[model samples]
Target: MAKTWFITGASKGFGREWAEAALERGDSVVGTARNPDDVQALVDQYPDTFLAIRLDVTDRAADVAAVQQAAEHFGRLDVVVNNAGFGHFGMVEELTEDEVRAQLETNFFGALWVTQAALPIMREQGSGHVVQVSSIGGISAFPTVGAYHASKWALEGLSQSLSQEVAGFGIHVTLVEPGGFSTDWSGPSSKHSEELDAYADVREAASKRPSASDPGKPEATRSAILKVVDAEQPPLRVFFGKAPLGIAERDYESRLATWREWQPVAEEAHGA
Candidate 1:
């Protein structure tokens, strides 16, 4: 059966790839981008199968309205992809409060609001999938992207809890943690703080990291996502890319070691 998908940030990158894949498979897509013109090409191509809408994910009201609009247009929404977010690069001290807030607004709260809006519709229909596009940084922090990591970490926690909360209603939640993908996430879509000489080493290391033109392929991501959407029961958390899986394993191992090393201290805190 063909599904109806509502995808945010569908103008480019993984979001665009997902939208294209759905349309090619005979599914209809309600694709949203901040600049409608960015997705005009898709509208021209998919015509009857695609509806391009202008949206700023940070606006809760607008997000809710967009969700409703999409559902009404397609008569149903089978999947919702919260893929509208940008990367913020800078040392913790270098980022302004406003910068951090802006990142959280779009990456964390934006998804939260969209989920909130979509849940009711899904609940009424008794089925739907919500895909949250996080990053490997959500599970492990790196130098220079503290704000971005914080936002994704919050999103991970939110999505995990949401998956449990909505299971009774037949709504599934998926958290996608992608590593070095060939997306504009690290290029035109990314934001950077003012350079500080004190953080030269951090900046230098970050500079060597891969960019949007790197080895990762968006098509692979799209295919993986489609598989997840088609599955009878999708995973709670899915990691993409070789680097992300390796990093996640190392992070969990380090966390286990730290927990064991601090077990005595943790036990003592019980006041036995």
Candidate 2:
């Protein structure tokens, strides 16, 4: 069956590649980006199958409208991918309050709004998939990318709660944690929070070429999605790349050990 797909940040990166992959598989796509013109060319190529929407996920109303438009355009939406996000790099003290919110708005709250809007349509239809384009940072943290990591970690927590909340209702939520890709994540698609003078040295260090934190291959990422989409049951989290695999593995081991070390204290608190 040709499923209908709603994807944000479709102008570039995984969003664009995923939309293209879905369309190539005969599905319908409503693609959105902050700059809608990057998608104009795609819409022209796949007139009957594509609808390009202009949206900035930080804008609540605009986010809701984009999701609603996708549902309405396709008569029913089968999948909604919240892929709009920004990377704000710098020491925490260097970022302004607005810059921090802007990062969370597009990365965390943006996905929240999209999922909320899509839920009604999916619930009405009785089945649907909600995919969040989170990052490997969702599972771990690094120095310069603290802002980006915080947003992704919050998303991970949200996904944990949402997975259980929506399970019995027939809706599924999946989070993609990519290591790094050839996407513009290292280039224009990414953003950096400015220095507050106190962290001038930190900002300068982060601006260096080797300071980029993204690590997923675009083609491999697209392929991973296709591979898992049709599986009998997809996992709540999919971590892409050798780097993430290693990091996630080590993180799990360390956390598990810590938890066991404190098991008696935890049990006492729970009266177990």
* Model 1 Cα shift for residue 158 (angstroms): 0.5
TM-score for all models, in order of appearance: 0.97, 0.90
CA lDDT, candidate 1, residue 238: 90
Candidate 1 per-residue lDDT, tens place, 1-272, comes to: 99999999998998999999999999999999999999999899889999998999999999999999999999998999999999998899999999999999999999999999999999999999999999899999888899999999999998999999999999999998888877788799999999899989877876786543355788887788889999999988998887887777888999999999999999999896
Expressed as tens digits, the lDDT of each residue in 193-242 for candidate 2 is: 76577776766765663314654568767778876566557889987676
* RMSD of every prediction: 1.5, 2.8
* Worst 10 contiguous positions by lDDT, candidate 2: 207-216
What lDDT score is found at residue 17 in candidate 1? 94
Off by over 4 Å in 1: 209-214
Off by over 4 Å in 2: 196-215, 264-272
Scored by Cα lDDT, where does model 1 land? 0.92
